[model samples]
Target: MVWNWQQTDWPEFRYDSAALASLEETFLLRAGELFGAFHHVNPNDRDTLRIELISDEALKTSEIEGEILNRDSVQSSLRQQMGLDSETRRILPEERGIAEMMVTLYRTYGDSLTHYGLFSWHKMVMAGHRDIQIVGGYREHDDPMQVVSGPIGREKVHFEAPPSNQIRAEMDAFIEWFNGSAPDGKSPRPALLRSGIAHLYFESIHPFEDGNGRIGRALSEKALAQNLGQPTLIALAYTIERNRKTYYEILERSNKSNEITNWLVYFAETILEAQANTLTRIEFYIAKARLYDRLRGKLNPRQKKALARMFREGVEGFKGGLSAENYIRITGASRATTTRDLQDLVDKGALTRTGERRHTRYWLANTQTDQSPIERRGV
Candidate 1:
């Protein structure tokens, strides 16, 4: 079956009152919940800190370009690109582009909304997957770009070429609107909605030779933080990856019908799902942190210092879970001193011994309760 490659008409996308109302209601409720989760500081229940940590983990996880571009390889390469450790690897020019893209996003946060910001994004998208057959280069040549897995897959395209000039102009217009929209006296577009719209439009434009999907997703974050002032905590990529087939289908459906309502709904629902998943992870981590805090009294000064270092740096052994080696490094003590502290900690029940000998590690003791054996032992 041949699928039609139709152009989008911006004028047709009017907000449906009922849909808008429903969206508003949902966002309001979500916003309130998010605010509480992020801002409410409970010393005994440090859920907000966990939420922050989980969000960072999600960002690192989602930054990788998986199977849509070799999932496993992309992740492995991306970690190298992050430049966090000392390891070095040779990168293809295209892969370098992806690396640069990850760096820009991670470092800049929401500031990547300016003209320069958009260009950097486009440059990386083009660089990352310039050789892919689906769409390559700014101009369409003798080879018609194939749209696989759609009603139009394997069909020869015989339509007016996408107007590059018009695309450039429309993109600029959107940027202009976005940069100054808050001051323009127009009722604010919801940040979540704006992110959805930006994704839909960028995909509709499909400007790059390849890697448009990843670039669009990256830009969606920019629109969220810049246009909406909210950093996206959910993994949109994770959700889309899970439903890759439906993802394309929904995007195609929106294009064919020029109806954004369904796309908006899908995008919003994915975000909500992602947020809910994040909430669960945060709660679990918070519980772990609370358990660690409760066990602090059982720890001596050196053990407490070791535990704090583990929490601050997230070292392998000290991640709310302590170990003898961690105690040695954290306290800057000799092996004998560290060993004595570890044993004392175990006796006080501030740490529990697991495994055996040098293989043994200490963990927060009695994580479920605030009681400490140190106080009981009068240590």
Candidate 2:
């Protein structure tokens, strides 16, 4: 029988600080840099970036659990929560539920984590879903909860959670520690390390019959926000999704081992990656702002809409840039008008034309000039 963390001395999760010292320093430094960059963004761009970041986090968290949500609906739900205009005309209950939970977690970053709070969050996340079998509060039965992989009849048990009876006491202890621990106090554990431990511990407890993974990730984000003294836009789930296989393997390995140094290291590295990715997005937003300023009076509404789409899609924005037909479809313009618009953009140097005749397409010109904000910062 594999001994889980609960079978150990409990509450005391020990690891060598010297082992993770370098990583801890690196993560903290990067997190500081990301936060500093965020502070420099103008109010308009900051709000836009916040919307994008939260939407990505909510969508990716659900996607990790094999639940694919419509991105537009999620965006609309988040927009409504943020008091912005929603693009989607209709919102699904699932989208609204996830968005509500995300906004709550973000806005209430300083609040104490409680049993009732977790129950409410679970209820909100599971609200209006007809197919889920688990109740919102907690597991009521004594059935063993196991995580398994492989074929249905020949499943390989990866890990078994503590029996249902242990959940109440275990959760209470978790809540207490989470509420009390501070990164800067006399007995200090780095916030990133606490985030990793909290995540693994919550998942191991398996308090809910379902949605454990999503909730566990959300708890980690909450811990990070508390440490920073503000809400963070770092999307850890996006990084985790890219490293999904390694994520599960490390969790199982740590659960079975006496030392969780490896898990801590992995968690630190993931935070670094997430912060770096977020920095890139911030840079992109800065670039977008500069581009908009440059073309403020040069481009028409259709051109501006098309350019916005290109910026949003990044490298994935239409393989060879957007063609005339594509522009027409997006802007609801007739062919003749679309042609004139495209030519106008090319003439104004906002876009560069490629190929000829029906094969012609337009790509955003190099918008960063010598004096642009992104260029000034050497980005």
Candidate 3:
């Protein structure tokens, strides 16, 4: 079966720009919203936002590859790379690798994509591995790089990358296209279009032996960031990982030919969804900042500790939702104190409770995604 790169017109992707124009416009509009919200984030707080969002994308990107790195380790590594932390501490190789790549991507996204830059990213991704015929360089193995699944006898090949000898030329052209197709390049494209195409193009080549998906996603993130003139806050990998099965299906389908309008639409919608999710996170942070202001000196030490712990879990609000036992565990309070603290939290609007008696669960009350308090007042 012919793949996209095997086509006579391989890599000359075709799509209806009109079909994606609306999505492109909406993307810009939402980006404006995000920029405005982020603008209000206190400079110090924006650093925290950067660390959290970048760490989340790093974690989710790795999760997509079926490799789960410790989230705390990822964040800690990011803190160090981003210069937010300076206390030298031991970090696992696996954790430090992706964090370093992400931090580097965020810092140098505007720089042109080159062989050395990509090699650097590949080495960062395959940090601790002792195996693999090639780590930071293109695969020179004789066996075809086939993506497959199923048991030994019934293995089904999902896709196979171009042969090793073809990689250098393919990557050279891809890097050229990536740089030349940017928003301000000689052949400029819209934000989402450039990002979507870059991702599809890079994935079709599957240039590296491993971490191609992660690096491809990173390339797309760079593409998006280049358009906006800043590092993107959108959780592209996190959003894609939610519907991973469908993501693979669409990608597989798109790889068969270069007329990739469907793929572009799918990817743009994913970016839009990611953008919204990011906005919610920013608004949640805004709400957290406001809540802290509201709660100053109003709560006991236990409540303060509990609230801080809950907020640490971010907008998701402590896994499985916060419970009285959870609060007690967090604050080391007795049953009576736990009940009182929970009730007091609910009363003060710091948290909202659901269920009753033994089943009671709580979440930060102000984290309404529909609107932030500042927005609701029409500020």
Residue pair clashes in candidate 1: 3-152, 66-71, 67-71, 135-209
Candidate 3 global CA lDDT score: 0.88
The alpha-carbon lDDT assigned to residue 72 of candidate 2 equals 76
RMSD of 1: 11.0
Q: Which residue runs of candidate 2 sit more than 4 Å off their true CA positions?
A: 85-88, 184-187, 314-325, 328-379
- Name model 1 segments beyond 4 Å from true: 1-8, 39-103, 106-115, 125-146, 150-166, 180-187, 291-379
| Candidate 2: residue 327 lDDT (0-100) | 91
lDDT per residue as tens, model 1, 226-283 = 5435554544565566566666667776665455777777776665655554454444
Backbone clashes in candidate 1 total 4
TM-score of 1: 0.58
Q: Candidate 2, residues 170-213: lDDT per residue as tens digits?
A: 88878877877755444545778878888988887888988889
lDDT of 3 by residue, 1-379 (tens): 8888899998899999987898889888989989998999988788888888989999999999898888888998998887778867778898899999999999998998899999999999999987787888988887888889999999988888899899999999999999898876789889999999999999998888888999999999999989999987788998889889978988988888999988898888888888888998899989998998888889999999988898888766787789988987888899998988889999999999888888889989878677222111100
Clashes of each: 4, 0, 0
The window of 10 residues in a row where model 1 has the poorest summed lDDT is: 370-379
In terms of TM-score, which candidate is strongest? 3
Report lDDT per candidate.
0.55, 0.78, 0.88
Please say which candidate is ahead in lDDT: 2 or 3: 3
TM-scores for all candidates: the values are 0.58, 0.85, 0.94
